[model samples]
Every structure is written in C-alpha cells, then in structure tokens.
Target chain A: DAGVTQSPTHLIKTRGQHVTLRCSPISGHKSVSWYQQVLGQGPQFIFQYYEKEERGRGNFPDRFSARQFPNYSSELNVNALLLGDSALYLCASSSATKLFFGSGTQLSVL
Target chain B: QKEVEQDPGPLSVPEGAIVSLNCTYSNSAFQYFMWYRQYSRKGPELLMYTYSSGNKEDGRFTAQVDKSSKYISLFIRDSQPSDSATYLCAMMSAGGTSYGKLTFGQGTILTVHP
Candidate 1:
C-alpha cells in the first residue's frame, strides 16, 4: 500500500501572501495530522483530524488551519505568511498503532 | 525547558562502532515512547517503540526507556553509513488529546563514516 503523499513538493511565497498545502492519506486510514519542522528542529504538531472532525490542535496561531476530507485527505492552509513560516510541512496518516508520513511540502516565505 | 530534551549532536562515528542516542523528557505522564529515523529532505519513519519502561531490540538496534529517570536511549551496533540521519525521540501520554498527538525532541544527527 502507498504511504502518505503530499503535493507541491516545493513552494515559494511572499511574506504577506497565503499558501495551501495538500496531503493524501494512505488507503484505509482515517486520521490525518499536520506538523511543521523548522530547519534545525523536530516537527511541531499543527493539527489532527479524524473522521473529518477536528480532533486536536497545537499551539500554532489561528492563521494556520486544516481540514480533512471525507476520503481522509487533508489540506493545511496558512495565511499572512511570515519569514518564520518557512519550513517543511509534514503530513501523517495514522492507523490503530502507527503513523505513516509523507515526504513533506517545503514552503519558503520570502 | 522543553517537554522533550535531546542533544542536537552531529554525532560522527566510524563504521562498525557502536552509537548511542539519548533523550530526556519532562513529562512523567508519557507512557508511549518512540524513536524515528529521518533522512535528508524526507519525513521521519518509526525506528523503535516501547510502552512504559524496559528495553526492546530489533536487529542491531536497541531501545531503552527508564521511566524513573525520564530518559530514553537508542543504541545501534555495527553502525554503517546507511545509518547516517537524524534520530528523533517522541512520546505520547495515555489519555485525552495527547493520546494521538506525539511530542518530539529536536533530534540528534548521526553520521557513520565508512
């Protein structure tokens, strides 16, 4: 089975612009989570969605939002991008026991 | 202090040597401990996972967790160049929103020179 997959492998945006990143979870998986990994740091949880309902959210600001589709795919939308927002955005899908992650979308805010 | 503390070591070791990676966590409620390996520009994959304390071994890798000290370690035997990557330690609590959410350490970079 395929692992989690994310789109727009790379993206660049202006400081004040907006960005939307997409992720497709593995087949049969019903939970999806988003995390942000800065250049020299580990991934920080952003949001988690299960059964198309928001299950949990991290300390990120309201500008960062996410939603899960009926098919368990997810999208992370970040607005008012700042230079600090430049990082690799990772998407993970979970089963009962483990999480499968995608290669991630690299977003650069200039 | 961060909930999970890990030395961000660009730890370099010669091949066939033993490598040890460690993390100290502040959360006593965390019951599930996990280690992940991440290659450059890729997402992390689970290396070892254990519940509560005790040690678990797989192949040349061994994961040890000490709940009393709030410390966890990953040991690699006969390290090879392929083992070069960032090793991350993550933990999750037993109940509430934390159940599905994992708190991660900064990660230690390991490079095994051939």
Candidate 2:
C-alpha cells in the first residue's frame, strides 16, 4: 500500500507571500499531523487534525494554520511568510500505535 | 530544559560493530517511547516503540527504557553502511489531554563505514 504522500516536494516563496502545502494520509487513517523541521533541528509540531476537527496545536504563530478535508487529506497554510519560516514541513498519519510520515515539503522563504 | 535530550553525534563506526544511541527525558508523564530514522531531505520513519519501561528486541535492533532514570537507548548490532542516518527519540503522554503529541529529541547522526 502507498504510504503518506505530500505534494509540491519543494517550494520557494518570498517574504510576505502565502504558501500552502498538501498531504494525503494512508488508507483508512484518520489522524493527520503537521510538523516543521529546521536545518539541524528536530521536527517541531504544528497542527494535528482527527476526523476533520482540530485536535491539537503547537506554539507556532497565528500565521500558520491547517485543515483536514473529508477525505483525510490535509493542507498547511502559512500567511505573510517570513524568512524564519523556511524549513521542511512534514505530515504524518497515525495507525493504532505508530505514525507514518511523508517525504515532506521543503519550503524556502527568500 | 528540553523535554528530550539526545547527543547530536556524527558517530562513525565500522560495519559489523555494535552501535548504541541514547536519549534522556525530563518529562515523567511520558509513557510511550519511540525511535525514528530519517534520511537527508526525507521524513522520519518509525523504528522501535515501547510503552512503560523495559527492553524490547527485534532482529538486530534493541530498545531499552529506564523510567526511573528517564533514560532510553537503542542498540543496533552488526551495523551496516545502509544504517547511516539520523536517529531521533520521541515520547508522549498516554491517556491524557496531550496524548498523541510527540515530543522529540534533537536527533543523533550515525554513519557506518563499509
């Protein structure tokens, strides 16, 4: 079976621009979580959605937001991007005991 | 202090050697422990997971947890070059409001020489 998949494997945005990254969960998976990983650092949690509802959120600024669709796919949006927002964004889907991750979207804000 | 702490090692070892990676935590409420391996530019992949404290072994990989000391370890026996990557330690609380929110370590980089 296919694993979690993310789109626009790479992205480059200018400061003050808006960007959206997408993810598709594994079949039958109901939970989708977003993370931001900066160079040389572990992934930091962003948002988590389960059953189309927001289940949890991290310490990110209000400019960062996400939503899960009826199909269990998710989109992460960043508005008024800053250079500090440049990082690789990862998405994960959960099973009973573990989470399956996607290749991630590499976002570079210039 | 960070919730989870791991040495950011670019440790290099020869093939067939035993490799040991470790992490320490400051959160006593964390009940689920996990290890993940991430390659450059890719997402992390789940490796081993344990609940509570004890040791679990699978094939060449073994995971050990010591709740009393808030310590965990992953041991890879007979390491291979393909095993080179970043290893991350993660944990979370169980049966509470923070369940499923994984806190991660800084990750350790391992390189096995052929």
Name model 2 segments beyond 4 Å from true.
none
* Alpha carbon lDDT at A32, candidate 1: 92
Name the lDDT value of residue B19 in candidate 2: 98
> Which candidate gets the maximum DockQ versus the true structure?
1
Q: Model 2 chain B: which ten-residue window has the lowest total lDDT?
A: B92-101
Q: Whole-model lDDT, candidate 2?
A: 0.92
Error of 1 at A95 (Å): 1.2
Worst 10 residues of 2 chain A by lDDT: A92-101
Q: lDDT per residue, candidate 1, A1-110, as tens digits?
A: 88899999999999989999999999999989899999889999999888998989999999999999888899999999999999999998887546778999999999
Where in model 1 is the C-alpha error above 4 Å? none
Tens digit of per-residue lDDT, candidate 2, span B14-114? 99999999999999998999999999999999999999999999899999999999999999999999999999999988763355478899999999999
